[model samples]
Target: MKKVEVIQDFPEVELVGRKLGPFKEGEEVEMRPWEASVLEERDFVRPVRDFSLTGVRKALIREEKSSRLEELPSSFYRTVSREVRRLREGGEVEKAEELEEAIESLVDFRIQKLARMIISSVDLGDIPAEEQVLANFLSQPLTVWEGSIGRVFEKNIDKEVGVHAKKVRRNI
Candidate 1:
């Protein structure tokens, strides 16, 4: 769900077989994200605290300074993607490019951090609901890979130790 503030008056709209709002200017409402996105496309409303470059910068800096994953709004990535698309369509190419670079760097850093957490068997603290799904998905594959690799090493080490033990016994 997203909370949006209406910027223009809008009459009741029937969408997806449901009637939504006769919203007035200055009204704030909570709606399904899809509905809010539809209204947002038409400029009827904007997200209260829409994603901004300054916010992204702060998040990036915070993430860099921490071992734990930085908490972000649940719809953080979706909001950033939408904003970047809007910027490109509006001919704000330079701003869009800068935003894309910053977002990419942040995403890459978070991914690396998440992988480290998973490898270390550490608790995933303060992760957004949206990213929790990603962590869950990655956990299974990583566990499998680690088990497979550990078994291979275990077998080789066991064989080497056995051979060394037999050699020592013979010398004794």
Candidate 2:
């Protein structure tokens, strides 16, 4: 297989009619399978905006989060959800511990929609209007249907669940 050269590259245009610049050499741009994503809401559209490092960082974060889930085996989700259901009505101590774990796992601005409902009583300070909109959006239920770190632990509660990767067998 030919290796895609490490270079700066992006789609030519954005949905908002913005054009991206030509990639410079020596920059690492992802050219792997499923490298690009498409958002189909209307007439053919793609996110092809020219952005600074922040834009790239957001894209990379989104990609990394997606990749993390995709690398897991099929049986991961059902197992975790079952465990969550079992632990859902756990005692105060267990609930507190799970809450701590959830909070610790949250990113800088990980605002769940349920949190917004509770936060609505607080006075809006000097936060920007745009950020407030995002907060509102985030207040929606986060129904993430995918493999997660907690799932791994829940699945192997009785025994050690080592690394998942295994050697591929050839039939030839």
Pick by lDDT: which candidate is best?
Answer: 1
Error of 2 at 81 (Å): 0.9
Please give the RMSD of candidate 2 to the true structure: 22.6
Q: List candidate 1 stretches off by more than 4 Å.
A: 1-50, 163-172
**Residue 153 lDDT in candidate 1:** 66
Evaluated at residue 5, the lDDT of candidate 2 is 28
What lDDT does each candidate get? Answer: 0.84, 0.37
Residue-pair clash count for candidate 1 = 0
Task: Give per-residue CA lDDT, model 1, range 1-172, as digits (tens).
Answer: 7889999999998998999999999999999999999999999998786466766877888889998887787778788999999999999999999998889889888989988888888998877666788889899999898878877766666687865654444210
| Candidate 1 lowest-lDDT run of ten | 163-172
Clashing pairs in model 1?
none
Expressed as tens digits, the lDDT of each residue in 1-172 for candidate 2 is 1122223433355444544324344443433223233221321222333222333345335534651211222332343344445556564457545533542333232333224433453443433344356555654433221235345545554255344322332211
